[model samples]
Target: MAQLLKRTHMCGVLRAENAGEKVVLNGWIAKQRDKGGIIFADLRDKTGIVQLTFDEGVPEDVFSLAQTLRGEYVIGAAGTVRERSAKNPDLPTGDIEILVEKLVIYSKAETPPIYIKDDDNVDDNLRLKYRYLDLRKLKMQRNLSFRHRIAKVTRDYFDQNGFTEVETPMLVRSTPEGARDYLVPSRVNRGQFYALPQSPQLFKQLLMVGGTDRYIQIVKCFRDEDLRADRQPEFTQIDMEMSFVDVDDVLAIQEGYLATLFREVMGVEIQLPLPRLTWDEAMERYGSDKPDTRFGFELKCLNQIPCVKDTEFMVFRNALDNGGDVRGICIDGGSKAFSRKDIDKLTEQTKAYGAKGVIWIRKEEDGYKSSVNKFFAPEQLAEITEVFDAQAGDLILIVADKPKVVFDSLGFLRRHIAGLLGLLDNKQFNLLWVVDFPMFEMDDEDGTMKAMHHPFTHPKEEDIPMLDTDPLSVKADAYDIVLNGVELGGGSIRIHDSELQAKMFDILGISKEESQKKFGFLLEAFRYGTPPHGGIAYGLDRMVMLLAGESSIREVMAFPKNQNAQCMVSDAPNAVDTAQLAELGIGLCDE
Candidate 1:
């Protein structure tokens, strides 16, 4: 029988200082080699890996037991620490190895479905199903450790900054608006449902009212929305709310947090008060509100080009006449890069996003070459090319449609095309505050205007008067932090006055009674003298993914659900028993 032992040192903790001292180590066997007379085993734990060697001369029984060890078999070794005969320069514990005089095989493990190594070849579903084993891999373990460090640093920073970490409710009354809610039927209160929070928006505001002053919670929020590579049904948000704060105050506090966070998490000091770009400026330059500013392929407006009216290109003329837009970006040395087939496929993708088509102008060795150039004579082509400052080997891709479609298509294309050309440098950290978003956006279906951020976001003071007139022209105090074309988080100074809140609801097409029904308590609280409040919530998982240099948020998560929102490991979202369903007075309608 194997002897029980107490561990004096971790497998990865031995060094030259303890060379003459005896120690005990415990870990799983990462690898084992048998050369008949002598056996060697590399033991691995979460900390790192260490090697153990057993020779017949040291102990015949220990050598005999070491020979029985296999990969992933749990074991304990008690021996005198010694210098390694063959030093492994690559390993952390390379200079030292344990010379085993005592060996204990604790438990044996079967072959794992997935290899406990980085770059293991296993299907994602299978890996998730055996996430415990998958997490045992060095890469996954490192990701988790990095995530924990970031989280700890963030919490500590906030705590130092006079913010209180509070826990909010997971089950609350369903007050639906933004995304579909995940409802849980309450057995105690029949037919009534409790919805998982899409966010702690309302509760955070209430906390401000309750005088929490500065509140932060690393909380789990749920949204029943379509999943993407970066999205999961249940995800964590580093939520925060502050009372008696204006836009500047909120930004200042956040900038301090970010400076500390970046220094702690990435070892890179981010300069405080990062650059800010107005929503219009960002969209006009990169065709995206969340523009990746690491590379330059800025959008150039051709709406003022004189030939646009007389070009005879119907797409261009119709768009110009219909109060739409014509914009394009000059790709550096792209003339020879994209062929006709490639441009056609780009046009197809733009069309899917509602753009009519894409037009291209190439500056060749001689002159301008374009499919639409037939409509423009030499003089006109020359004038248009001159406006764009065309150069040899340069390609100009243009889109003409409604302003929205034009921006959306070219914006997505700029990033996509830049990625294809390897123009974006991921090593650079680019942070921009996109502010001055329009207060309301027109719904294409009914032309009804709705708040761009949310109804509670306070409109800019000057634009507040325009709420009764051109609401669409009004801008809000909202700002989003964009990093590499991803909106990391967003928040706004809220409308705390009850009258303003009611006015916002009116503009959003929610009636007085309707507002009361959905947000009656909040409206009532606002009447009791609420302070100026604002807050932001960051996608903590995505933030950790960036810190870990990971491609997907799933890599940073321990046991994330798949794209379909089902947990392969836990088998969550599974069907309940028929008797339980009957108790809830519900049954599937389908046959």
Candidate 2:
């Protein structure tokens, strides 16, 4: 615990220019080797790794101490920087080596379960269980450092743009925000509970009413939901809200932020005024709201084709008879790529997305080979390829189902097939603004109309009339920022009028009393002249993950929960003591 020598230089920064300089470095011993009575080891700090040399020139005790070094041993080495006899072209500090004069052991470490190397190929659970050691890897350290830089850039960009940083409550009243809330039972108010904020959705809007013109917060939000690569139970959001701003104003400010963030952090320039696609157009063309425009598997409707519409084939005929449509996507050169067994496997996977089956046609060199050639004439098969301009070496995949299912099937198929073909490139950035989302969508199970976004999103001015007659046909003043195929974030022009707010609640099947019971504070605040405010919240984890070209947000997070929402390192979500539960007037239920 005694201080021997203070760190004079980082391990990675000792360059050839700094030869003859006496420096002290504190770090873990990454590797150790003894060749011809000279001890050489790689010393690592957060900055980087450098070679440390201990020869017969050092004192007997110092050389004896250097011999004990091993991987992950915490130590301090005071030495003179000199030119390396053998240079490692792979390292930044490769041209120089530290010749040790004194040494001190801070702590000895056991052999780590997980290797402190980037390409170890260790098991996921083992890496998580020993995350502290895993983080020592250069890749993880770089990922965390990159994340820190992103946070700093986010704060700097918003602050320079006249936005006030505001902190909101962690524990607040819970309204239905689509996702389930993680509730904390109150001990003081027996049997009462405080729900974690799904977002600062209501509070941010209330800030607008309180006359805060521009607000920003890199805030934490919670959602008790299913976990995936991108979804975490607890996550951070680069949340912002603005008062007296329309869609254009909010979007312009956001684009400016993106320009600044990408240019500074990634050294990439994002072109101004990003491309846009309406919700309808996105679904019709790509069959997805968050359309990945990097590839060309665009969906084409087969219902209007004369041969397909009039075909006696049950797959097409039955779907058309029941108000459904037939649609397909053409894959260039896919005829040679997909075998019948491969197509069958893909067909099975589409069933999980509610597709009945897949109908395929391969345009060969000689003629067209079709799955439904028995039903359709040769001319009809030729017309199928004509619909997609599909030439020889092209494969057309068709899905016949209800419009929604049909679109959903093709949406997933395009992306899945693209992945199989290695067509999605992370280096290629495709930023798009998806706007004019539907105000309401019919719930498949209940057959009731639910708000496509939340209820507070302002309805399109012209579509307000349809709230009484056809609310599902109405659109909202909402926009989502999408990258590749992922929806990075979304915002809407909030309903500022109380009457309109009430109409939204009513249309979503919430009664007058029920609305007051849930969102009374927000409803009451809106009565006193709320502004035409709009806001967006970006998933900070997702942003950093994408920036780092990582498949999972877990790679960027310091301590992330596993697939079942349990922390492997800390063994979180464990049972609490009975007294603690009793104090909160709660009892355990059988699992």
Highest lDDT, which number? Answer: 2
Q: lDDT per residue, candidate 2, 233-290, as tens digits?
A: 9999999999998888999999998889889989999899999899999999999999
Q: Evaluate all candidate structures by whole-model CA lDDT and list the values in order.
A: 0.87, 0.91
Query: Candidate 1 at 131: error in angstroms?
Result: 0.5
TM match of model 1 to true structure: 0.96
lDDT of 1 by residue, 143-218 (tens): 9999898789889989998999999999987886578999998888878889999999999999999999999999
In model 2, state the lDDT of residue 260: 90
**Lowest summed-lDDT stretch of 10 residues in model 1?**
378-387
